[model samples]
Target: MDSRNLIRHKTQVVCIGAGPAGLTASYKLCQNQIPVVILETNPIYVGGISRTVNYKGYLFDIGGHRFFSKSQAVEDFWTEILGDEMLTRPRKSRIFYKNKFFDYPLKAMQALLNLGILESILCVASYIESKLFPPKEIRSFEDWVCKNFGKRLYSIFFKTYTEKVWGMSCDEISADWASQRIKGLSLSKAIINSLISPNANQDRAKVTKSLINSFRYPRKGPGQMWEVTAERIKEMGGKLFMGTHVC
Candidate 1:
């Protein structure tokens, strides 16, 4: 690449990518009256994984992007960005395995019944064994999950889905990833919650992200969020360079 052909800009801060986090950073910098420049490789889209694809007047998201958060600040930020345009929708997730539908967050009675009496007994024994004698080293996602939910339950509920989504075996993935995603969730807690408050409020701060029963989303798709945020950033004097790559 020729030096003269390169585009140059002066800014106190430079943000790479126009995803949710990057755009949020730029928006905040602009709010504080700081000079910031954002560089996004994709010229046509801004939300990265959250981007909405338009095909012949139809809109679709790359993946399901739910707007549920336990943090008040996160909720406030989304409301600030797209007020009145967000829709509250019930969360319905289920796993199809062995020709049976299993609820996510695992309803104890339901899951046990679905797995059958013999399998359920084995699962309970496995869970008790894990509680009694856990693996000394917690290194990978497999270790973390097995320790928390037992090998039988982990294999049934988590292993295949996690590998399919992330394209990695449980042993290959770091424990940190599991810790972050499955934090504050345990088999015991889930069972107790299922029995007591089966339909807990999704907005409650105590509700974990994975267990939320409802969430908010933009009318057009999640991309609308970044698009609006980008406009707001520009309105506040922040610069955005699309179709640009940082070398």
Candidate 2:
């Protein structure tokens, strides 16, 4: 073997995939004076699936992935890197159901009122029925959500979009995803929590308080942050090979 190849590498770390997770890891590692190399398979984009794609001056994403971490370290790191370019914007999420739109994270009363009396009555009936005749074991996503929130709500809000995203029937999908994603959330629990503690979702004085109002987004797009970081890495005598595919 060549002497250069035989020599030990001095770099402290090597990270695969230049996506947000990998990039953040590399950034933190380098901050501690450790040499790091980030290997990305895709040459054109450094931000991976979360990266923005520019087409004729219009920006689009593979999917709508918003940055909203409850971690202070994550928030601080993003703010530091992006600086003022990160704008705090309000979240505007909604669910399309039966040719009508409903608030997401479902404010119970509002959702019920919006769903109207007949559907709402059916929803409550289903909930009581499921509770009385609970499945011996929740085996699938549909079964899990239906058992917790009832069939009417699940059919209107979850079934279609989830099927579209996963390309699988809710019955075919495992219940683990539902359990993890909506952990500690139920229609009764939501109503009770909202009534008892109106500010439960507020950004309170406590470090563990939930954030409800706003989120940070890059001025142009998320890709801008990675591009800037790549430039900084190069300025610090690091190598960055854009448009070069690595197997």
Candidate 3:
């Protein structure tokens, strides 16, 4: 292990983001004896959009991001990196509908009951109308959603928030988003399932269960995890370049 030979044979791996993906890659590479250089634009932080920020001594995230992967390898990797800092948290989500807060993955009976007789009747009517005269091509997201779940349900559950997120009207957006986001979901099925078997293996129900439940969070937030990983990488003869941007 001569110094000259070490300098000559040094392996270099440059990772750009220093986010979860980049940090994980760097960690694995270092584990295999490969030298890594992480370049990040933000000088004060390494985590990307998933980064956590402290405001008035309170840690706040860019959004509600949780670490929950279906892959065991990913889970194991995080557990190894985070150790006891990883905490399992119960999920709490709600939907604001007609100035009322309702549990997300909307309880069908409760939702309909809350909508009242007139609105519920309109929802039923819209569903019946769509069923009788189904759209010819299902061109837009609005059309697809209305056809499947009806106008009232779509307006209540999908319209405003979706518009806010995508910055587009339901008609302007592609059906692909709706199809992928709410695949195999329908108001008729939801109501019937609620009445008959609420716990049936419906695709939407499964997706909802997978989403709103429990998730892992680092003790100080996601930034702490990346900071520790970065430290480990540096300790393993890696170089981290902060405030470096690459176009």
Candidate 4:
């Protein structure tokens, strides 16, 4: 290709990624009559962590994407993309401990049934002890979790999973990572939330993404939403350059 023919075109907004963040921004820009260009490092696909992968006509989520957010506009934007193709799904997950299964989001009654009276009593005592005397120096993930949920619960629920994911002892991992990734709810908050009905505020701003029970998902896969979003952007006079890798 001649350098002269490869003259760079000008754009008002240059989106560096074609993932959810970049694509969403571009869609809004195009909606408001602004010109934009998208640059994605991946040769194909769009949703980023929320993207779905296809194998021989079978689609699978690369990372589970529960399209839940505190922002009504964000939720609306997702609905605008998929419309009826979106499905609101109830969450169902479980915790495995000592050959026992406990429902997640933890119904207190279920936990009591699963953990038994003696174990439950010990867990409560541990929680009270942690509350009364938090570890003096809170540095590691273990320290943080034990201080909040208690040593017993941490050992059963957190320690194993944390080690498995990071392949490091909890004492080695920093507490800051917990603050950044696991915000909104704590062990105390989870217990309280389970005991009561959702607050009647009805404000989307108050909703926490992590604790929400229901979320929207594309009927086919998350990739379908992005595919349609890209098409709409093109129809609105936005340029989509596929198979183009940029640093």
Candidate 5:
């Protein structure tokens, strides 16, 4: 690489990666009339994981995203970009257990129907047992979850998937991960809440970041939002160089 042959340019801000954070920062900086350059490693896409993948005639999300943001500014940003193009999608996640699908967020009726009377009884008994004689030392994710949710529920709900995700025994993962992720959520609380309000997440205050009944998404896909945002950035005289790496 010759020094004179190498192209050089100057900007007030040089953003790395055109992911959500990077793109948002560049958009804001350019809006303030500050010169900015965005370097996106991806050659063609803008949204990173949130980018929509299109085939011959099919459209799919690379990694599914729900357009519900805890921040008002984010919500406003989405609205400003897509507006009526956004559609509200209901959450309906299911997990496979014992070769059967179990409704996520624990649908009381579905769990009872799927697990059967005998297994349900055993699970309830196990919950009672855990409460009566919880592990004295709750250091691991397994211990904390077992104490709060019972061994039977933990084995059925959290065990296999957790191991698959982290590639470690339940005891190996830190309890802090569980505590931080599902602080207010517990098996008993979920059961009780279901009996009261089947879809317990009407209020965001009581809901975890992962738990949302419904969320807005662009009609085309999440990529639409970012594409529009990128266009806005370019219109504002922001320099965007896709397929460019920071090295």
Candidate 6:
């Protein structure tokens, strides 16, 4: 064996992926004066799904990642990393169906009006039926949603969109996905919250991620956050090896 071909490296910690979590771990380690190395397969990008793509000078996120968390510590960490570079923007999300747009995190009145009288009545009936005869065993996304919002509402609001985005049938997807994504939110809870007075005690921290009205984003893009983080890590004596794949 050629001695020169034999390479050796040593670090207190080795982080993989270089995505938000990996970068964050490396950053913290570097901050504590610990030697760390980050390995990322993509040579040009540091953030995984959180990366911003530059196409003909137009910047767009790869996965539409948002900077919102139920944890204050996570929020504070983002602020600490980006500081003023983070922009607080009011979230405006909509779903387009049947040549019309409907608000996401759906407003009950707006949804009913948009769905029309007959469909609305059917949806209500479905919800009541679900309440009266809940599924004995919840297995998939379809089951969970049908048990909560009912089959009718799920078809309209969830089925098409979810299938299109995920490229899988709702029945094929795990109930865990629905539970996690729609955590702390249900049709009844949504209606109750909407009916509550505007001045009611609604702590922002306690609000679900889906219901968040505003969120912070890096001025340039979410990629900027990781870019800055990588630089900071480098300055703090951490090594980042891009274009490196780990098996």
Per-residue CA lDDT of model 5 for 1-247, tens digit only, reads: 5643332233388889887788889888887677888999999889887888778868887866778776899899888888899889888877898889996655655786799899888888888899999999989999988988778878988888779756789899889888875576666766777678865644533467656678898999888888888999999999899999878
Model 4 lDDT tens row, 1-247: 6653344233378788788878888999888777888877777888776678888989998766677776788888888888999999987667787788876544455675688999988887998899999999989899888887789988877788779756789999998776544555466665565456444212221454445667788998888888899889999988887667776
Against the hidden reference, what TM-scores do the models get?
Answer: 0.86, 0.75, 0.74, 0.73, 0.74, 0.85
Could you tell which candidate, 3 or 5, scores higher by lDDT?
5
What are the RMSD figures for all models against the true structure?
A: 6.0, 5.2, 5.0, 6.4, 6.7, 5.8
Off by over 4 Å in 1: 1-11, 192-206
lDDT of 1 by residue, 1-247 (tens): 4543232222378899999999999898787667898999997889988999899989989887889877889999999999999999988889998899987766677898899999999998999899999999999999999999899999988999999877789999999989888776778766666677865423232556676777899999998998999999999998999999888
lDDT of 2 by residue, 71-178 (tens): 788888778888999888887677777677776666667678788999889988988888888777899999998889888788888898789866889999899988
Candidate 6: C-alpha lDDT = 0.83
* lDDT, candidate 3, at 169: 92
Residue-level lDDT tens digits of model 6 in 12-78: 7889888999999999878766789899999898888889989999998886667988688989989
Off by over 4 Å in 5: 1-11, 121-152, 159-183, 195-209
* Superposition error at 48 for model 5 (Å): 1.4
Candidate 2: segments with Cα more than 4 A from true spot: 1-11, 130-144, 163-184, 192-211, 237-247
TM match of model 6 to true structure: 0.85
Choose the strongest candidate by lDDT. 1
* Residue pairs that clash (backbone atoms under 3 angstroms), model 6: none
Identify the candidate with maximal TM-score: 1
lDDT of 1: 0.85
Question: What Cα-based lDDT does every candidate model obtain?
Answer: 0.85, 0.73, 0.78, 0.75, 0.80, 0.83
**What TM-score does candidate 5 reach?**
0.74
